[model samples]
Target: MTTAVAATATAARQGPRPRGLIWTVLRVHRPALLVWCAYVLLMVGWMLWVQHVSGARIRAELDACRRRPEGACIDVMTFSHSMNEGWIGTFIAYSSYGIAAWAGAALVGRELERGTAQLAWTQSVTPTRWLTVKLAVPAVALTAGTTVLVLVYRWFWSADEVLRGDEWYYTDPFLNRGPAILAYALCALAVGALAGLALRRSLPALAVAFGFVLWFHLYLDDHWSELWPMRTITGTVSGHDLDALPASHFWPLHLMTTGVVLTVAVAATGAAYWLLRRRTR
Candidate 1:
C-alpha cells in the first residue's frame, strides 16, 4: 500500500502526461507537418544557393549588359536567375493559400463532417478545447516554419542586391522578407479555421478558405501602398530616382500592412471562439 501511494505521488509530481490532446493533434496532423518541414527546408536551401552562388556573377552580367547595350543581353544565365528570383516571393505567398485550404478541408471541417469532432467531444475533451487544439497545432507549426523562412529571406534580402533586385515596395518582396510573412500565414490559419467551423463541410470550406486568402491578397495589392503617407520630395524630382519612393518608406508601409493582417487574424479567431461557444452550449 505504501509503494502504491508513493507511485501515485510520483506520477502526480510529473504533472500531465505527454500523450494528451496536443500530442494527439500532432499525430493526427503528422502528414501536414512533414510537408511543411519539407517546404521550409527546400526554400531555405534555394535562397542560400541563390545568395551565395549565383548572385555576384548575375549582378556583374546584368550591369555589363546595361553599360554596353550592344552585347547579347538575353543569355540563359540571366533568364534563369531572373526566373528563380522572381518566382520565390510568389511561391512563399502561395504557401499561405495552401495552408488555408488544408486548414479548412482536412484540419477542421473533415473532422467535424466525419463525426470525429463530435466523438472527441463525447470524451473528457470539451468542444471548445477540441477546436482550440485544432487551431493551436497548425498555428504553432506555421509560426515555426514561417519564422525560419522569414529569417532566411531577411538574410538573403539584406546581403546582396544583385540579380535579386526586386524593390521593397513589391508585394511578394514585402511579404517574404519581413514580419508580414508570419502575419499573413496566421491570418490564413484563422480565416481557414473559421471557414471550416462555420461550414462544417470539407470541400466547400477548402474552396472558400483558398478564395478568401486570395481575395485578401488582392485587397492588399490594391491598398497596401496607401497604408502609410507617401514621402513627398521638393524640387525637380521628375525622372530622378527620388521620384520613386525611397528606402525610408519601406518599414512604415510594411509594418502597417502587417498590422492590418494581424488584426484580421485576431478578429477571425474571436469569431471562431464566439461561434464555438454558441454551438457547443
Candidate 2:
C-alpha cells in the first residue's frame, strides 16, 4: 500500500506533458520574435512622441505663422516633410518586405533546405501541424504588432491634419493607415512560405518572396484608386469635375483590398500545406 501511494504521488507530481511542438517552434525563432517585439515597441514609442511633443510644437509654429505671416519656418517644414516622407513611410514599406524575406529564408525555406522539417515530421509531428504552427504563430504575432502600429499611426495622422502632412492616397500612408498593413504582412508571410515550400532553397525562396511582395504592392498602388467607384462632383456653373473621394470612403476601399490580400494569403497557405503533404507522402 505504501509503495502504491508513493507511485501515485510521483505520477501526480509529473503532471501532463508539455506542448513540445509550440515550444520548439518558439525556441527556434526566438530571435526573430524579439526583433519583431522591439520593432513594434519602437514604432509605438515614436508615434507617441510625434503625437504629443512634435505635434504640439508643429501646432505652435502654425499659430505663430498665422500671427506673424512673415517667412516659412524651416523647422515646421522639415518636421512635416520627415513625418510625411521619411522614417514613417520608409519603415512601413521596408517592414513588409523584411517579413517576406525573413519568412522565406529563416522560417520555412531554411528548415526545408536543411532537412529540419523532415526531421520534425519523423519525430511524430505531422506535416500539416508543422505547417499550421509555422503559419499560425507568425500570423498572430504579425497581427498584434501591425494592429498596434496602425492604431497609433491613425491617431498621429489625424491629430495634425492642419499641418498638411501626407495625403491618404500616398502608397505608404494608405498601407499604414488601416488594417491593410496587417493583411499585407500576412500575405507576405504566406507567399514567402509558399515560395520556400516550392523552391526548398533559402536564397532563391527569399528572392522570389521579396519579388512577389514588391510586385503585389506595385500593382495595388497603381490600381488602388479604381478599387472603389468615384463620386463625381457637378456644379451648375462649374460642370462635372472628377474629385478625389472623401476620407469617409477610404474604409470601404481598404476593406476590399484587405479581403483580396487575405484571400491570397489563405490560398498560398493552403498550397504550401498541400505541397508539404504531397512531398511527405
Candidate 3:
C-alpha cells in the first residue's frame, strides 16, 4: 500500500473518538497561555494594592458624606483610586477582552497566513478536527482568562456598594455569566477564523479582526439592552439602605444578539472549511 492509503486506513480504523482539539492547540501555543495568566495576576495584584492604599480616602469621603445629609458630597463606591466605575475594574475588563480578541485573531490568523495550517491539515487530521483544535485552544484559554477576570472584579468590588450604582457600567454584561460574554468571544473568534481563511495574510487578518472587535464592543457598550436582549438589573441605595430590583426588561435583545453571534460563528467556520477544501496549494 502507498503512504497515503496506509495513513487513510489507519485513520479509518481509529474510528471516531472524543478529542480535545482545544487543549491540543493550546499546548502547541503554550506561550500565549503563560502570558494570559501573567497578565491576569498582575492586574489583580495591582488593583488590590491600589484599592488598599486608597481605602482610607474612600472611607473618609463616605464618612464626610454621611455627616452632611443634604450636601454636595455624596457617598460612592470607589474602584481602586477612581470613583468612576469605568476607570478601574471595568477598564481592566475591557482591556482583558481586547487582549482576548487579539489572541483569538492570532490563533489561526497567523498560522494560516504562515502556511502552517496547510501543513497541519494535510496530516492524518481531518479538516473538521484541525479547525476544531484551532478554535478550541484559544477559545478555552480566553474563556478561562475572562472567567478569572470576572471573578476578580466581583470579589474586589463586593465590599463597595457605591460602585454598584452604575450597574450598566460596572457589571459589563459582556463579561458576565450570560450570552453577552459568549457572544463577544465567539464574534471575535469567528471573525478571526473567517478573515484568516479569506485574507490569507496575517496583517490583513489582524486588521479585519480588530476592526470587527472594535465595532462590536462599541455597539454593545452603547446599546447593550437595546441590541442584546439582556436586561440590566438595577439596584438602588436609599438613605442607609440598599435595595435590589429585577429590572430585567430586556431579554429579547439578548436572544437576538445570541442568534446573530451563532450565525456568524457557523458561517465563518463553514466558509473556512470550504475555502481550505477548494485550495490546490
Candidate 4:
C-alpha cells in the first residue's frame, strides 16, 4: 500500500502543473526566442541605417530652403510629404512587415506544428494556464521591443525641420506605433495558433500566419478610405497634402485583434487539453 501511494504521488508531481509547464515551455522555446531577438536587433540596426540616409536628404532639403528667401523656397513646405520618398521609406516599410509578422510566427506557429501541445497536456496544467504562458512570453517581448521602437521613431522623426514638415510622411504608419505592430503580431500569432492546432503542420501553419499578415496589410491599405478610423491620429500641417488621421481608428483594430488572438490561442489550447486528456486517461 505504501509503494502504491508513493507511485501515485510521483505520477501526480510529474503531471503538467503550472510551474512545470512554464518551465517546459520556456526551456523548449527560449533558444528560438533568443534567435528572434537577434532578428529584431538586426531589423533595428537596418532601420537606423535607413533613417540616417533619410536624415541626410532632409538636411539637404532644409539647406536648400535656407539658401533662398522664405517666399522663393516656399516649395520646401511640401517637405513633409517628400521625406519618406526614398530609401528610408523602403527600409521602414519592410521593417514594419518583419516586426509585424515574422517576429511572432516562428514561436507561436512552430509550437503547434511540432505536436508540443500533447506534451504539455500529459502534465498536470490546465489549458488556460498553458495558453497564458505562451501568449505572455511573446506579448512581453513585443512590449519591450515596441517601447524602444517608439522612442527611436520619435527622436528621428523630430530631428529635422524638413522631416517634421509632413506629419503623415515622416510618421510612417509602418514605423510609427509599437502598439500597432504588437497588435498585428498578436493577430499573426493567433492565426499561427489556429493553424498549429487545426492543421498540425509547421509549414502550413507558417504559411497561414504569413498569409494573414499579408492580408492585414492589404486590408489596411485597400480599405483605408473606409477604415481610416483605427489607424492614426489626426493633425494637419500648414502646407502638406496628407491628412493625419486619428489614432482612435486604430484602437478598434487593436481590440479586435486582441480578441481574435485570445480566442484562437485559447480555443486551440482547450482543444489540445481535451484531446490530450482524453487520450491519456
CA lDDT, every model vs. true structure? 0.85, 0.83, 0.62, 0.54
> Judged by lDDT against the true structure, how good is candidate 4?
0.54
Clashing pairs in 1: none
lDDT (tens digit, per residue) of candidate 3 on 1-281: 69999999998999875455554676667877797788778867765765565665777777777778577774344543454434554555455345434543577667766777778676777767787677776677667776776676666655565544345333453344345555566667767777777777777777777777677676655654455333333454443444232435334555665676667667766877787677633
Per-model RMSD to reference: 4.2, 3.6, 8.8, 9.0
Question: Candidate 4 lDDT, tens digit per residue, 1-281?
Answer: 99999999998989965556666666777775686577567656755654576556656776877888767665543454344433443444344344334433555445555657556655876555666677567667756765665566556555544454444423244335435444445555555555454555666666765666677556654443343342433354665445444545454544443454455445644564464345446
lDDT of 1 by residue, 64-143 (tens): 88887476577767668767777776788668899889988998889989999889988999988888888888888888
Error of 2 at 179 (Å): 1.5
Report the Cα lDDT for residue 161, model 3. 56
Clash pairs (backbone) in predicted model 2: none
Q: Cα deviation in Å at residue 107, candidate 1?
A: 0.9
Best by lDDT: 1
Model 1 weakest 10-residue run by lDDT: 235-244
Query: In candidate 3, how many Å is residue 143 off?
Result: 1.9
Native-referenced Cα lDDT, model 3: 0.62
Better of 2 and 3 by lDDT: 2
TM-score of each: 0.86, 0.87, 0.67, 0.59
